[model samples]
Target: MLENIREKSQGVTAKVILGLVILTFAFAGIGSYTNSVDTSVAQVNDMKITQSDFDKAYQNQRNRMAQQFGEMFDTLSADANYMANFRSSVLENLINEKLIDFATAELAIRVSDERIKQTIREMPEFQVDGKFDNNRYLALINQAGFYQTSDFRDYLRVEMTRRQLNQALIASEFSLPYEEAQLTGLQNQKRDIRFAQISAEQFKASVEVTEQDINDYYQNNQNRFQNQEKVKVNYIALSVDDIADKVEVTAADLEQYYQQNIAKYQQNEQKRFSHILIEIGDDEAAAKAQITDILTKANSGEDFAVLAEEFSADTFSGENGGDLEWIEPGVMDDAFDEAAFALSSVGSISDVVQTDFGFHIIKLTELKPEQIKDFAEVKDEIQQLVSTQKAEDKFFELQQEMARLSFEFPDSLEDAAGAVGGKVQTSDWLTRFGNTAPFDNAKVLDAAFSDIVVKERLNSDIIEVNDSLALVLRTNEYQAANTKPLAEVSEQIKTMLIAEKATEKAQNIAQELLTAFKAGEDVTAQLAAVNASFEVKNDIARFGAELDNNIAKEAFKLPHPVEGTLSASTVTMNNGDLALLEVSAVKEGEPATNSNFAQQHSQQLAQATYKSFIDALRDQAKITRREVVQSSEQF
Candidate 1:
């Protein structure tokens, strides 16, 4: 099962949906990570997943993971094995997409131009006050990493076609009563077990770590104990923090600012609504029947978003689960506006409303009333804004002046600092792999290490850290990269060797105990001789959280005991702890009869059906791979 692969991997359908979502958030300034060489990394039939495509997709996935993990991401990515798996999984997702392309093409699935245009129109991001805005659409596509609207349209065409194919497979899935019962039994299975932890920490104190072991380990792994290249620099810093305090805004200034930006203080009443549109096609009755079924589902407390995405003819809004975002009067068709605005409360649905286009079942998701802030109500905010603007203006002026001085006097930042009424400050040691403090930005590190600043012994140009801060730097001192002295790392090596030896000891003991238990020997007596006891857990469910995660996973993974004999095995843990697992009893749950169980079963089967089809396509596809460079970036 692909479930055994990337943790119940949602498969290529999920990958495409994720790509579509990230495309919306792909701001203009996000740096491109693709290579200049246009080579195929993977191919399906005549179609190729180019290096550029792979790089862009990988960057998107990497960004998602980084956002999810935050500070812990640095530690996870530092592991070469972990990163290698991550890169491979990302490439596999792309390869799966290529296979989908071939399958969809072979099946004659294609998204029409009208569908594409409608989808674009329904997109809430491209709309202003609920009406589709062409200018907003153009600006957003550029921000979403597309230089041309046609390019985005082409990309959307492929994915939407794939979505059509995916939807067909999902809609065709059904779980029979017997299938649901069978799955419920397995899902709710329980195990009664007793396990003894053969912890490595118990053996660590007894494990002998000799001087020779430390020396040998240290000699073989010197790369692990190297002092990375480092540098300290003298820099002239200019920031809004330095300038904003010196600026002042009077009470009259606040009033004038409030009056100048009065539009910003006014908020019009708006409501968020979603609609399922059924166009008046050739068979009007069939269209009405389809919409009636959808309306029934929506009224019965079914997820309106899911219903919208599945059935709405308005492709643009359907893509966002039928959401048109916030809208007031007159933005949409007169009929739609009248029906939607008449809803007095949130989560209320309007009756069928007819327009030239078709019929709509509108759901009022949210409503916000109008607001106006008087001068006194927002005086503090206005003061801060005025001060910030003044500081920004001053920051730009000083940045230009400092840049001119730094270039004219390349040898030192002292003159530049004097010009800006600031002093030259020294940085902590910054390494090639890890930077320190305010100099941690990539641009700052690049400028600090550039040939002009380091080798030529000249000041760097003004590097903008952000909108509020900029700096000019020159190298003060440099240290050559070298291995750390043996004296400094000897104890570290000794500790490592001890841990390794201790793990070995734990494994041996766990294995010996497993043999005794399986052979019906008196292992409990043997274990009691040592200061350890097996913890007993009775009737443990498959996903019970009370047990340790590592142990619980293994407990369910163990095969059932047979012929009145316990199933015994030695399990090695992630933390180098070993466990002697003995399962004494097993129970299969009674067949479930609940409606929720059947519904859950159907959803699971649907996803499985879709993934199985994709996997089959992938297996039959002529896929190829090429060696490409991997990024060596660190957080």
Candidate 2:
């Protein structure tokens, strides 16, 4: 699935930053300059996926994994083996994106700025107390590394384009009765099976192991005994904490800083304002100069909205005479905010304030009075600033001493530890290929098995798995993979068989019920007589149309649910069961009362239509992705 949100990952900061960059690229920003020119990774239509593109995507995915898994991140870095897998995934995604782009262009479908704006306005992320907050939205984008809402909206445009492309492909595709009937029988099936489950614990008393058996098992699986290659690295970590401890805040310093910016900490009845954006590109010095001329007109008393329409690059807001909904303090660039708020009354235009976007002439559309959020409220922030400066100095000093000691006792774990006065700890036994405690990091695990650790029986070189930390490892012992004897595994096999049988029986019963119904029998009555319960919930529709499963959706789509057999439809249960459904009734979804609900349903319907389109295209398309296995390791 193309997830709408970046799933929480181990290294969130890196992933989020990369995500923003990716967004930037889609908006025709500096990201394109960073694109890979290599031609081996992906084939998008006639275009090849460049190595740089693959690397960017790979880095994003790797960082996401680390963030999601946190300290227990088990995946190896861009090792030779992992790189191969990364390349394959990146190629596939690139190919898919390219295909969609081509199809969208061919269809002449374009996502307009208005659509992007509407989408942004509807996003729940920008809401405060269930209403869209202009300031909050801007703050979020800034924190996520966006320079402007324009860049973010451009990303939404690409997504919308892809979605529309998919919908166009699937519009004519519909499931027929034959398909529906098959699906219905699978869903309505019942299982009435009685079985005994004998687990491993049940036969524990009857099992016994001998040393010979253990040796034989280990000998048979010799490949599992071999260790994977690993590296040990040494490095230093620089963090905010390392520099925040030594800084000291003096009373006079705090008071002076506090007095200088007392207004910053003061809460106020902030006015809401927004502006139409006119962005100047990095290379468009000439265009920017032209923009300055337009700002001059606004400063000369011309209506800001009128001038925005004449020259603003923001097509969406410009159409509305450059009306930017509502905004609050902290919603704009520092210079722009300062000028806008400095105005004494609404409708007053301020002199030009230069920001990266271009020259801006601020119009104080509204104003609110001050409330108390005094400098004392933010005294801690000032204190931390002073403390951070001191900490930074101390950290640098400590690092210099640590570096000296590390160089003097290179490859000497005990000597280095003693020199630094830090404790030296030993890790539990870890295999190069095992995922047991304290050895999940493949690189670190490999280092423990290297010649330095194994032959010399010494601490391996300091290994850095991630940017923030480093470690040295010494292997204590090795354990090989061995299969349990058949006697020990028999109970496990039996339990699995029982579940499989039950599932199989249920499918058979479901098929029988559907068949009987088609033959004019009361299938529900038959079920009851057999002590098998059947549910006949009504008014189920497709997603967005209604909230229901595939079976329910199919039922609601049927033409004659009150009498004739329903068109069989497919339904996949949560327990991994695929069933055929026969519609019992047809009830269209109710009319939504709230705007939010209406929008939600609209989006869902659009997404469903889009997915159907893509599926159809896939069926008619011939695609071949080269399989590159750099190593035996599987993701």
TM-scores of the candidates are: 0.62, 0.49
lDDT of 1: 0.81
Q: What is the lDDT of residue 181 in candidate 2?
A: 50
Best by TM-score: 1
Model 2 whole-model lDDT (C-alpha atoms):
0.56
Clashing pairs in 1: 119-316
Model 1 Cα lDDT, one tens digit per residue, 1-635: 22143333447876888887688558532345344445777777777877677778877887898799986775576465887788788888988888888788789998876678678888999988877766577778899888877799898999899899888988887778888888888888888999887778877888898888888888889899988777889998899988999998788888888888998788767688999999988988988888888888889999999989988888878999899876656456789899999997999998888887898999999888878888788888888999999899999999999998887777788888999999999998887544444665657888888878888778888898878889999999988789999899988888888898999988888888888788878787767754567999998988866877777788888888899576878787767788888787889887776788877777898999988998888777787777644632322
On residues 461-506, what C-alpha lDDT tens digit does candidate 2 reach at each position? Answer: 5555443334544544544335555556444444444455555555
Q: After aligning candidate 2 to the native by TM-score, how far in Å is the CA of 131 from where it should be?
A: 4.5
- Global lDDT of each candidate: 0.81, 0.56
Clash count, predicted structure 1: 1
Candidate 2: Cα lDDT at 580:
42
